[model samples]
Target: MASPACAATVSGAPFAAMDFPLQPRRPTPGQRALAEALARGEAMMGEGIEQLPAATYTDPDRFAAEMRLFRTLPQLVAPSALLPEAVSAVAHDGYGSPLLLTRGADGRAHVLANACRHRGTRLVDGDEVVGAKRIVCPYHAWAYKPDGELSGMPRAECFPGFDRSANGLRAYPSAEIGGLLFYAEDEQADFSDLRALEPDFDAFGMAGLHLYERRVHDVAANWKLIVDAFLESYHVQRLHAQTIAHFFADGITVADRVGPHQRAAVGRAALLERADLDDMASLRRAVTFTYALFPASIVVVSPDYINLLVCMPQSVGRTLVEDYMLIPEPPQTNEAAAHWQKSWALLDGGAFGTEDFGAAARCYRGLASGTIETVTLGTLENGIADFHRRIDAALAR
Candidate 1:
């Protein structure tokens, strides 16, 4: 049977009990700092103004440097919600190379090249999540198990000596943590930093959530430019004036760091007057949290659902973004479906697709004209500065 629908918004409250499947967890020490600052009507600020050269977005050499950073590190594959069960596979082409994401009888997901080992033909054909119980190569009829173990060949005696164990699909070094998948071409890269996000992920209960919908956006702007749009709330009142501005207090977003990642809490002044700060559910309703994952990924926790985006650079002037909408569970009724559909249309269409990305594209065009040499970040926009610094440090290493 379908799970019951999430309760409608109750009273004047921002959160409804049935929207979240897991028990609310207390904010982490770092996250608590964000909440405390929100409760005080203050936000974290930079010591001074920080400026980034326009070349960071328009220069070919600089863009290559940024791409190098991705090559040397593990890239986030996809949110775990996309493949929530065993015997599943998805064709993911957002991260540059074509990759087949599979989960076998082992009940764990693995990242594999989309090519068949025998004749190098594509194994997976579409973007739909499919059961990878057994993949038959459309080119040569060579079959493989979900784990990439070769299972059959058209004519067994055709090849003089064939070692099935030695002829499997190429697999990347990967791990699933915090409902996110991280994989790398290098076999020895460290994932301890990614592992450290467990406490935060546990609080969000991301692992078991249902994937409601997903869209791939091809934007005409530099990837960092798009990422910069989310690291600050300074533009919401103006850029999103018609959509989400009324939901926030002006000049009020507190940011904290978790290793290389960033945590930001949007101020909702109502929380300052509440006496139940100790109640996590109430606190969650009082403020919205956003995570700026290192490199370029974002998680925005709404009152009832989550918006997760992964940004990948396609060129100095272009980017490809994979956007996913996650909910506690699939909507079980027409009313529930309408509610989520409305939420998706508002966020994916108005707030993000049109406002946020539009701003990035406009900024990219101006920077490319060679008129502005530097982009400046003010005290309120310090999170963007901090993020760029981390990027520089990682590239230097």
Candidate 2:
């Protein structure tokens, strides 16, 4: 489908375009829960304090369970905008397996195993492959079509009874929605958890947005800890006081869950003075919407751009984070470029890297000390509790 058109502003200049309309003013059921929970001064608590045991972060068995949850369940792999054209492909290594995402000749995206079926050789080595008609295995010179079909073999006549069709690359079960690509190792894995966020996904124009920049961080903490840090605003005043503390209201947040995914918005200090709380779109302008897609993806929507943080677990105490900054469009002029550059410097460089992840590293040291039996989540930190509950549920199943 064609993208939505950009409207004109009062001065006749083109307004920044978005694929979907602004979110409605009426509160969704989840939003209402958030409002009520805030009024009660209670954060959404999980089953019990035992839900977050220290071993959940440091134990090998728990880490293995978490890894199984990641591989067997549907997880966000890449944004649709990353493969905008035919013959485009990107390699990902976050899901405990090497994955190759390719846009085929028909312009449909596909997720395939990166290993060649011929001799189990890696077809593409780097993070992305663009404008390639076929994936050629470096070891055997076997080539496969972008859709994972076996196309050519080096010595076909050597094996008279060889069946090329049976040697095609293995493909993972994948789905594209709201401009994002999700895949799971288990072909029968259910994706209703992700599909339930269609309304919020569309409202944010996730699919139509362009990826502006990306940064990778190797954090010294469990993946869950990093997820917890982003979903709450309780630490903003103390941790980010020098950077973004003044911009946001302290200790005030609203959160609601859409199936396995959860979203939380912390009020901006500038808008706290306004009496009206009914206009959702206006409120969105004043707050940052943090959507934690179960398993490990967190998409943070600010007024100007979107930040996609993928927490990829590497070991019990190490996680690789890929942070992507997506904008409505590429900057056309020097002024626009400078503005986006400054935005990246503040959000990704200053606030996230320096403050958030830095704190996570220190927190990991304490958790690994073996003194604390369990960590606690406050009422305002309900998102963290909800996340742990989802993890336990997924592992149980």
Candidate 3:
């Protein structure tokens, strides 16, 4: 049986749940300061003449710097649930390199460079490999253990002084925290800073959630531009009016920063009339929370599911975005499955992919035309401002 919160509906609507199981924990000092700032109407006023030069979005040099920042900083790659069992591996191509994530026989998660040690050929191209004891390069048949150690080569005698132990797959620094898998090019990169950004992350039960579907979209826009689309609700009333506008209050968003990361919430208009606004449960049901993890990942939480968007830069003018929809569990009945499918079709296909990202592409072309010198952000769009500030800080390092 479903939990009452899960089964609850808004005035008899099938997919309209009035309450969500996950509630925001008590705000930290930084979060409290942000709340007080919002209450004082400070966050609603424009931050005065802020300008992100148009060249930053179209210059090849700036794009390369951004990619360098990504490689240096720790990034959330996938949810831990992707590799559910030992010998299970998943291939991801969004990052700078092809990545292979596997659960070793020892029950530990590993992130390995997917390229073969010899000839640098990708070992797998498909999304997933199940019950695999070893990974064999399709080109030269070089084999590797589940733990990423080189196990065999086609003919060992051909090369003199060839050491198998020294030829293992390159492993990136990684950790599974709050059910998310994070990796960085720096083998000694510290994830403590990233983990501190969302201390209550585990309370959301993200580890237990299962990936429902994954979609990859190639957008003709700068990666930062794609991320900017999700940082604010200012465009929803206009761009997403046909889809999600009716569900949220226009321009009523609150943003809080945790180090370089940000959490923004958009209130639902339907909940304003509720008598239980003081309660955490009721409050959670009345808003949508979006977390912009520093760099290029956005995690949006709704009552019934979570959407993760990861933007990967292909060039100054091109980006590849991987969108994953995650649900608490797999649907056990046809009715449940159908409901999720319809919900996904409306949210992912209509609002997110088509309306949001599609508009981003057009925005990029305009920026590239050099007609505008700077993109302005209003007080309501402080989340976007914060996002750009973080990028500037990262690149400055």
**Residues 1-397, model 2: lDDT tens digits:** 0000000110111123232344354444554444344444443333433347788788978898789888788888878888878887778887678899999999888999989887788778777556658888889889988899999988899879999998788998999978888888987899887887766666666777778888789999988888878666668778877766665545566666677777765543434334134554444455456777887888877656778888889998999888888777877777778777877877688778777888888888999999898887655565666667778887887
Say which prediction, candidate 1 or candidate 2, comes out ahead on lDDT.
1
lDDT of each: 0.77, 0.71, 0.71
Residue lDDT tens for model 3, 59-119: 8988888888778888878877777778878888788688998889987888899999899
Better of 1 and 3 by TM-score: 1
Pick the lDDT winner. 1
**lDDT value for model 3:** 0.71
Model 1 TM-score relative to the real fold: 0.92
How far in Å is the alpha carbon of 279 misplaced in model 2? 8.9
Tell me the deviation in Å of residue 130 in model 2. 2.2
RMSD of 1: 5.0
Ranking by TM-score: 1, 3, 2
Q: What is the Å distance of residue 109 in model 1 from its true position?
A: 0.7
Residue 22 lDDT, candidate 3, scale 0-100: 47
Clash pairs detected, candidate 2: 43-379, 179-207
**TM-score, prediction 2:** 0.85
lDDT string for model 1 (1-397, tens) is 0000011121135533245444566666766666777677776667788899988889999898888777767778788989887888988777778798988887788999899988789998888998778888999899888888889988979987889889988888889987878887777877887788877776777787889999988899999988888887677768877876666666567776777877777746665467255555566666677877788888887767788888988999999988898888889888788888887887787788888888899999999999999998877677777777888898888
Candidate 1 ranges with C-alpha deviation above 4 Å: 1-22, 272-280
